[model samples]
Target: MAGKRRKVPHALHSELSEYSSLLRALSTNDTLDVAKRLTESKPRKRKKRTEEESDGAAENEGTAAPSKKRRKRTEDAPVDAESTQNEAAGSSQLPEEEPNGDKPKRVRKRDGWTRWPLLVTDLRVPEFGLDEEIEALVRHCLRNNNPHPTDEDGDSDPEDDAPAWLPHLTQSSSAFLSSLFALLAHHTPARPQVMQDRLNAIDWRMVLDILATCGSVDADVINTVKTRMEAIYGPYDGPAPTRLEARAVAKSRTDAALDEADDAMFVAVRPSKRLPKRVLEDVDSDALDD
Candidate 1:
């Protein structure tokens, strides 16, 4: 009669079979013992032995044999207690351990560590520390060289033909380069929208090659600079221009020619410009009314 009862629907039966298979796979055929299969076995708490029980055990052992080892263990019990107390006292001053009674959920997660240089708002020597290499690069950029220093031939140009100082200038350090780019971004004369437009027009590949010439700068470093530039100026997805074009656009918007003093203050080429004064009217309102 029980077997004659209406059978589970085909769909429900198939689902149940699939679920059973999954459970079997997960539990390794120990489905009924779900706790044992799914959860780790915790160490059972030790049962404390009462003094009477210990004495009874000792008596039973002594009756069996009064071995030297047994006598030694009995004699050392007080010393062991003292040592444990001392250890407890020493550890009392230390920080408490985190509770680990429950096992943490096992999770497969992607690595979140960033390879790019950290974002910085400024690169003042006083704060970030002055590096002679960075200083040389800054000077080279601000000096008699063209505002947008680029070779028309781009990377195809012979390395020897490149400025002797260009290769020698040290701007490859990711942190330093990132900070310098940040400084330039913060001091740009163009509005954010204009700056974004200019950045979009840059030839990033050419820029990478130029930066590479300085040293074996990591791709991550160049990426860091690009990321900061995009964040501040806005995303630039326009057609790629020559490296020179990109640099010229950037130079036109920024004032990097001014020298920075040891105090991190910039020394402007001209502190202030005198403007032509306009003549004021000498006539009074009273004479006009009359």
Candidate 2:
């Protein structure tokens, strides 16, 4: 019965206003509708006759005139004109409504630099196809070389009159070189002791050639590539050979290939006609040709 019945109080609206403030402070936006319903359902107060007015009515008992009684009542309960005006103004103003449905926005931290995300289920190969020439270059570099006490590779060979035949560098070549260097530096998979020897065997000039060929690469990237190359090959004042030397070396290699009959895979075809020349004539002709 107590739950079914509701009672209205004089200060119900003021109490609801206080409750709303408390709800807002606690960040409870969901319960605002219930508060609104409670405010609307509160019972209205009924006008009552005062004890003073009833007693006065009995005392007068129609003896005194109605005008005299009215004057006496007005004198006893004096009203402030300003207070009445303020109350009227306050009553005319509507209560502000709360946005009960909206949820509070959350603050997020600043996003910084992030690495390229890799998942275990991702494709093992690169998304884009890599160049075959680049792969060949990487394989060539990765192949272990026998250790030598002296710096006698193609780069350091001074006595050879022929120029070295260096491979033409391309975009693919540079990319491959950079990636290989990264792999070696990072010691990918697992760090192996053989890496140091393989790195040492790598000719620094080859790395520079790759750098020089990369026309569109960033300067910072080039510098990093150079730094990594140096770390692998070690710092040196000697520079890579010029174009002329490389050409000469290429010529020598061609000559070497031609000199080898077995590796050349060409059958020797003897001349059908024999020259009827003296032994002295043959020597003189061969010397002249040379």
Candidate 3:
């Protein structure tokens, strides 16, 4: 009986098979679309936890575990901190050491005449016994060709004409020499060895030249004057003259000239044009009345 009833449902069976096939195609397309989306889309990534967050999470783990990890992290961190401190300290000290090693040292040369301290010391003779000797020297130099007589009663007796201190004169001469040396030394630039050799070679010719150009002397008189200067100031090697030394020399010369002028004979007149006669008379009359 069941087999005979099923023969009447053929159209219904065919229609159901066609609908099942359409549903299977739609399901296959949907699966293909999902596969394409999976291939094209970027993967979702888990973010890395910061140190603080990781430490907090670790702290939330048991107390024993967190304390051990924290101690290890602290030990590792100190090495970096110490290295940073050393770098900072080294950078700070670098500039200070650089100057000491790299900077040049400056040395000043001594003044010209000061280099002849020995000569100056020798010339600083006693003041009392040398007055006459100094006066004779001066008279000899100033008298031109005339012979300077020794006795006070001589024809040139000029009783007031007496010699002054020689040390004072020597001191002035030394100062002038020092200044001249300083001037020349300072102006000329040569190696110390060369300069010393040159100064050592200085002789009558150099002296004559100095006297001819700078000193108050004629070319013919320079030879004699050079000999006199050599007798006074000996050889020296030091720096050349400076402005200050030059000025000092000039002052010494001026002072010596003034001293000589003061020593020279000068007539003093008792004010010949005395206060007018009337003024004097009035003063005398007033005094007499009183």
Best candidate, TM-score: 3
Off by over 4 Å in 3: 1-133, 138-201, 223-290
With a 3 Å backbone cut-off (N, CA, C), the pairs that clash in candidate 2 are 162-248, 162-249, 163-245, 163-248, 163-249, 164-246, 164-249
> Would you list the rank order by lDDT, best first?
3, 1, 2
Question: What are the models' TM-scores?
Answer: 0.15, 0.16, 0.21
lDDT of 3 at 72: 88
Tens-place lDDT per residue, model 3, 1-290, is 45655464889988886676565444434433534643555557656556676665555554666479758876877657777688679868875322123223455974332121122222334356444555566666756544655565465554355446555786666666567766544433244763443323234444444444454433345445545655655543322223225645777899999988887747464666667555433357667789
- Clash statistics: count for each candidate: 0, 7, 5
The lowest-lDDT stretch of 10 consecutive residues in candidate 1 is 115-124
The per-model lDDT (C-alpha) reads 0.50, 0.49, 0.52
Looking at model 2, which ten-residue stretch has the lowest summed lDDT?
114-123
Best by lDDT: 3
* Candidate 3 RMSD to the real structure: 47.7
Candidate 3 backbone clash number:
5
Candidate achieving higher TM-score, 2 or 3: 3
